[model samples]
Structure formats: structure tokens, C-alpha cells
Target: MKRLAAYILPVVLLACACAQQPQVSEQTTTDTSTTTPATASAAPSAYDANLAFGPDKVVELKQPESNKVIIKLMFKNGSMSDPKGKEGLTYTTAQMITESGTKDMTVSQIKDKIFPWAAGYGANVDKEVTTFTFAVHQDFLNDFYPIVRGLMLNPAFAEEDFKRVKSNQQNFVDEVIRASSDEEYSKKALEDLLFRGTNYQHMVEGKTTSVQNITLEDVKNHWRNMFTRNNLMIGIAGNYSADFLNKLKADMVQLSDAKPNIPMAGQPNKPNGVQVEIIQKDNALGSAIFTGAPMPVTRSADEFAALMVANSYLGEHRKSYGKLYDKIRTTRSMNYGDYSYIEWYDQGGSFQLPNPGVPRTANYFALWIRPVQIGEGLKQQYAELKDINVGHAHFALRLAMREVDNLIQNGMTQQDFELTRKFLRSYIKLYIQTQEKQLGFLMDSRFYGRQNYIEELDKLLANLTVQDVNNAVKKYWQTENMYITIVTDDSEAEPLKQALLNNTPSPMSYSNLVKEGLPKEVLAEDDQIANYKLNVKDVKIVDSKNTFK
Candidate 1:
């Protein structure tokens, strides 16, 4: 009941806020002495225009919308198209196009043109696709559209601009990501561990060494080959006229129809047991832990529906009522939060909903444990515990594993299943709240070859039961064979590695003597969790500076 209330209370408030005015059945007459009554309004505009110019370009135009306009250009080729040594080439090229000068305008001149219209253009390069998004108000569409068109049609890859973008890319890998951040480091490390030998091994940003190797020739060559006419899909949603849509389509069709023969991602070999990669950093505050196994399921599969329900019960992205949240954060107060995912969920630690345009051909089930502060608080108790990340990391790992083991072993109850499904059905309504968001999701659905995911999920949840969810869990979810990546201090690597290999217990110990209101069963459960068996196949610590090199 407590868990259910945690989820339901907020939903009730949202429902009240969304209450609509009473509906009228027919037109009613009003007296002419005072005022005339207003006539009925027209039906809402169709959400999907579903117009296609050719085999290459498909457009989804939504109506009954606001003054804002969002245009997304999705190229079928992404980082996977990068040549052997040039990992970050695609992302660098995208940055150069968006941030660099155009053929007619300088970089600063391009910014000056768009800034007056309160519009901006950006690009995101994922594993399988590179999406270029253009956002502007309807009033400023004329000014913004031409600038973006210039970027797409005739980009001036100036040598000066390429040098600057490449330098920034290198700094991001060196200063911001690999050097300063544990959470960010763990994220990339997880991917590298999962797809070590494959093309999907590196982040879209590429590695530090790869960024250094990328040249002006590489960027220009990649852009010409990958960003061709046949590899594009345009998504526009706003208050645009039919004439405007036609013009945009015609302008987009001028490029040559050439598609790159990119290789699809093959399935990574399953982990033998719990493999661990400990990145040793001296100045780290807490351990950033991430673990997962590759999943064959996607939205197109029937198993995906059941997996959604089971994953929500285990850990729904930002929700507080997930089973992992209840077990780790609520019960023992281990970390800031604990969450699980059934797909390649980026920004799972902070964001409420999934971001669009990151549709993946290959997906994985992952768990993120935010930095733990155990060593900082318990240093005086244990002299060897110099790094707080190490201690908190050990406990957080055990707690996370215990919750997953229980869920996979015991499955979910009818009450648990019903509450999650009910919550999920209503929560999904919040996904496509705006015209731009709707357009983004629509493009993603088209990419996955699905018909309106939001509507389909509603129907699936309405009919799904506990048995259905558990059966999916048994088929897809697992604990024994998985990949683990943790970023922590060099001093604590051997201790942490030894702890995992030895199957040591990480029991929860209170600082104070008082044990007044705590439940004994919960405490006993933590004991078993501390000793939970992990078949750790390999464990090694590498220097932080050396990683992503």
C-alpha cells in the first residue's frame, strides 16, 4: 500500500490538473437581446500527415499545435560508419556543420542570423543515426530555415573551424569526462566492456587518441559519403502551410541518392559471469557503478511489452516506487538513487523520460548506482577504507544484486503487477505532451517499424497480467552472466577486486548504537545480500588517464 500510494498520489494531482470542460451535444439558441452564443469549433487536426517525398524522405506533420516548429534530419549512418582508427569522425563532422561557418556566412555571421529569430540548431550522433534538430518559432521560420538549409546543402568546412572543433573534442575526452567525472566515466566504460571488439565499442564522441588522429580530410570525406540524399528522413511539426512543406521537401530532394552500405551490429558474446573493470582514479570521491547484459528485445518484439512491465516494477527511470529504489535507497539509505533499465537509456540518473532520436538496433539491460559516500563517513572505523567510493560501492553493488536476484527468482505478485501497469498506462500519456516531443517520438516509431508506440503500449498494458510479466522476466532477465564497470581510486582497486572475487559480505552497519524502529527481517535480508554469490570471471584496474586513449 505504501509503495502504491507513493506512485498514485502524484498521478491523482496530475489528473485533476488535466480535467476538461463539459462537452456540448448540439448547438443551443441564445436570446438576441443581450449577446450571441459562440458556434462549435472544428475537429482537431490529424496528428500524423504521413507524407513521403520519395524512398529516402518521410515526413510527419502534426496540427492543432502551437507556434513552435521542430525539424529533425535523421541520417541512417552514425558513428558505426567511422573508419577503423577515426572513432569520433562522424560526431566531429556534425559539430563542424552546426558550429562552423557556412559557404555564404562565417561562423559568427551564422549565429547572428539565427539569434535574432530566437532559434538554434544542434546535432546528436548516436550509434546508429545522426539527428540534426532545428527549432524555431513560426514567426521566425523564414530566417531560420534558410540558415539550416545552408548547413545541409553547402557547408564550408573551414580548416580553422575544424581545428577548433577537434581541439574541443579532445578536451572533452581529457578534461571533462575521463579526468573529472566518475559517473560519466562509468557510462562509457560499460559500453566499451559490452562491445569491446565491435564497431559499437566507443562512445559517439570517439576516444582521445582517435580525436587527435581525425583530420580535415577525414571529416569532409565522411560527410560526403554518410550524409547523402538517400540516407535522410525529415520530421517537421508546427503551424506550417502546405506550400512551405512542399518547398522544404523539394529543396531536400536535390542531393544525390547515395546510401552507404553500413554493417549492422552483431550480437556481443554473453558474459561468462560477473566481469569487472575497475578504473583507478586517485582523486575520486565516490564509486560510479554500472552493470548490464545485452538484450535481444526491442519495441518491435512481443516480449518487449512484458519486459516493460517487469522492468518498471524493478526500476522505472526516475520514479521513487521501483523495487530497486525501495530496497537500496529507502531501506538502507545506500546512495542518492538506484535504477534499472531494459534498454540503452542515456541520462537515466537525471532525466524523467527517455530522449528521442536514440533508437538502437542493439539494446542492453542496465543498472546505474549513483556515486556512493560510504568511505567518507566510515574512514575512522576502518583505517584501510581511504576511498569512500570503494566502501559505498561494495555495499551498493550487493544491494542492487540482491534486489535483481529476488525479482528474477521469485517474479512479481498480482498486486505489484497491477499497480505498475496502472501507473504506466497513465504515465505514458505524459510522454507526447508537446508538438516537438510528439514529432520526435513519431520519427523514432517510424525508425523501429512500429505504429504509434504510445497507443500500442496503452493497449498492451491494459491486457497484461502478472503471469505475462513474469514469463518475460524468466525468458529475458538474468543476474549471473553480466558486465560490471566501476571508476574509483587506484589505492582501493585490489581491495575491491579481492572483495568481489572472495564473495565477501558488505553488511549495513549503523554508526549509532540505536536500533529502535528498524525491521529485523529487512536487516536479515541485507545480510544475505552482502553474501550474495557473484561469479566474477575477471577483475582488473587500469589508470584513468590511460582509458579512452
Candidate 2:
């Protein structure tokens, strides 16, 4: 009840204040002595567009609404079915089959076949699923699929090609990580801490550790495990042949077999004890402190909403959580702009970015403070942030989600909506509608090894309530086990470090340390977090309302 009251009180007062305000522009009444009655006004616009996601697999595909077609090809290949230790084997093989040369073709031969149509094409990897795609004229649909199939099914991972591509990816990783700026380093650091580790984490060119070890045999084995008919999901949306569909189906259905394991549902819970690790660079501008806890791998609708409410208090909402910026940075101003967020991840978390100079990491969830503050009042700064009124934070959550639902639904162009539906089609069918398979570990650990979570999530989202939001806060947010992380300049950070070490701490002096530690480069940049200061808004004073925990 108290949780509900905290959020409700501010709104009630705001409602009353609005009632007293002038609504003259929205109304027109003339001269003295004559009374005019007011007519009804239109209701405010509040739409939840996802309410249209619907329950069909074909996706209520809205036609070209225009003539040009959007081509989607499942472009399957023969990879991932073989062995484990040899990872890069199939990737290397693709260079020969699709990059240029195939059965009746040279590099030039492949392009010559399609050049007359002035079409477009591309390719990508998914561990178990890789694809080559093209967008060409509708008239050439029959001609295009045949060429794509020859390229996809016959990929040649030649030795010379493997050496060159592997070298390029390694160089890309080296350059990005080694050259990251101070900000970039901090960003990556956040990612590292967020996910706890990078095992289930996605990596573009793997890590420095894995990249160095990859062999051509690895690519081939990786391809062997993935390339097979049993694992294919093909979607082609354009003007094409119905009779050809049966023929196309016949050509690809012959091959099916077992494959190497794609890592399954394994999500790491928050680390039990509070600990901190620092990444050091000789001249780093400053450090970032990351505060976080494990969040559910997938949240209920209420918890998802409360993620907004919790985040508002933890980091981003300047108007509500702005006090965090003020108490930690502004009172003295060390934060160029520190951000707190429950970073998104459908399964575990992703890898740190390729930038070396910024803070990037994969910690599951975190509130990140950049640079360090050299201060004595460390305890007070931490305590005040917790002293916040979470009810006020709930207001910010409502506003953010209200806008997200509105934007996705009403603001989407028909073309984008169709594409979104298509992108989500497989996901919805496999995870929501059909429910036998879920993405990897999400099924095993979370669903009791059964498919219960599919219905659980649906029912939870369907009957989602405000009370659920309140309960999540009572269970997660208000818990005494909350952890803290603060990143700041190490040398200048000594004061806060000492203060944390010493019980006696000064408030004003500590605030100034947060300011002095910032790099001159960051100070020069007029960033929002850097200059943030707090002056609480003046709302009408109401009778005291106590919210006991």
C-alpha cells in the first residue's frame, strides 16, 4: 500500500494543480452576462501498439503497399554438422563457395550471372545459422534463388582465403581494443561487469584469447556442425512462383543430420559477494564505478515495467534520479555525466566492444559512474542516493514505458511493421506460439526443462498488474543486500578511498574531489553528466505521508 501511495501522492497533487490552471486556449467563451456551456473534448492519445503482434506464423504481411518487393532468403549452407574443436573450418570454406568461385564459375562468373539485374546481396553468421542474401527485381526471383543456392550450398573454404580473412579479423580486434579512448574503455568495462563474463557472450571476432587460437580446422568443423537441412528455416517474401515452391522444397530437403552443440540456456546469477576489479591504462583520463545486481534473465511484465522504475532511481531519469547526479557529481561536479541502466540482454549478455579507449563491459545490470571523485564524504554520497523516494521514481517509469508502447505501435511505418513482424516471426513461433524450442538455455534452467515459461510469460504479460510492480520493488529494490560500485580517478580517488577507509568524512571537501579528478578533455566537452547540478522542483507542500519499509 505504501509503495502505491508514494507514486499516487505526487500525481494527485499534480492533478489538483492542473485543475486550477487556465484552460483558456482549449476553450473559447465571449463577453460578460451570458453563460455558455462547454462541449466535450477529445480523449488523450494513448495507444499500445504491440497489442497487434497477433497469433499467426505467416505474419499479417502487408503487401508492397508499393510495387518494389523486399526479398528475404533463408540462403542455407552446409556447416556446423561436423566436429567441436575445429571452429573456423566452415567460415573459411564459405570464402570459396560464395565469395566468388563455384561449380560453373570464377569470382567474375558469379557476378556476371547477376550483374544484368543490378541486384544487391550480403552474408552473415549465427554459429549454427549463416546466410547470404540478395534484393533483386521481382521478375528475376526464379533466376536469383538458383544462383544463391549454388553459392550457399557449394561454399569452398580454401586455404589461401582462410589465412587472409583470419588475419583481417585479428587486426580489427587488436586495433579497436588497444586504441580505445578513456570513455570507450569505461564503456567496455561496464559491459564486462554487466555480464560477469563472456562465455555465452557474443563476440564479433571472438576475444583476443580465442582469435589467436582459431585454426582453419576450427572453421571447417564449425561449418560441419551447422550446415544441414534439418536446421534450416527458409523465408522468401516477394513475387514468386507457387509451383516453384514445391520444386525449391524438393531440392533442399534431402540432407538432414546431427550437429555440434550451440551453447544452450546458461545464465549467470549475480555474484554472491561484492567485489571490484579495475582495468588500468597508464594515462586513462579516469575510471568508471559500476553498481549492479543480477536481474531475471527474462522478467515478467511487471518486473519489466519496474525495471524502468528501478532504473529511474538508479541512473538515467535526470528529473527523478537527477539527485544521484547531484549528490555524487554536482554538489561538487565530478560526473561529466554518469549513467545507470539495466542494459538489455535476451539471454546471458554480449561481449565488450572493440573500442579500447572507452569503458565497455558485459556485466548483467549496472549503474555506471565515470571518472573518479577524490573526496572524503564517500559514505554520505552513497547513503543519500539510497535516501531517494522510489515513489517519485515510479513516475518516470510510467512516462518512459507509456512512450515506448505508443511509439512502437502508432509511429511504425507499414514497411517497418512488416519487417519487424518478419524478424520476430521465427522468434514468436518458436518461443511464444509453438513453444517446444526456446533460445538455448532460456528453456532449460528457466522453464523447469519443460515449456512452461512460454505460457507463464504470456499469462504474466496478459494479466500484468500494478501490484506486481509494487511487489518486485519490495523484493528486489528495497532489499538490504544491495551492492555499490564507484569508478573514479585513482590518484585523485585516493581521498574517497581514504574516506571509505576512515569513518570520519567531510561532505563539502568530498564533493570537490569528484570535480577535480575529471580529465581536462572531458571537462572541455559540454556533456550533460559533467555539468549536472540539482535544484529540486517546488511542488505544493502537502501533509506528511510516511512510507515505511
Top model number, lDDT = 1
Pairs with backbone N, CA or C atoms under 3 Å apart (clashes), candidate 1: 375-388
lDDT of 2 by residue, 1-549 (tens): 000100011111111111121111100112122222111132111111111111110111112221222222222332222123323334444443455444555545657766776554544443233443345566666676666556555545556656666665555445544344444434444344434333323232344444567776665554445554434433333334444433443444332243335444224345444333333333334444444555552342335444443344334522323334644455435455544455432111122211000111222444545445332223346543332211111122122222223332344334433333333223323331100112111212121322233344444444534344445544443211223333333333333333332322122222345447766654443233322221111111111110000
lDDT of 2: 0.36
TM-score of each: 0.87, 0.50
Find the candidate with the highest TM-score and give its number: 1
Per-residue lDDT over 1-549 for candidate 1, one digit per residue giving the tens place of the 0 to 100 score: 000100111221112111232111111222132222121132111121112244225555545245666687888887887787888888888888876767998778877666656666677788888888777777888877888778887788999988888877888777677765577679889888898888888878888888889999888888877886557787776667766765676566554345577888745558989889998887677788999898888887767888898888878876789888887778767666778888777555445888777888888898988777535546756554543433767777877887777888898999888888888898877776655556667777777887577778788888887888898888887888999999987656777888888877766554443234568897777678777777787887888888777
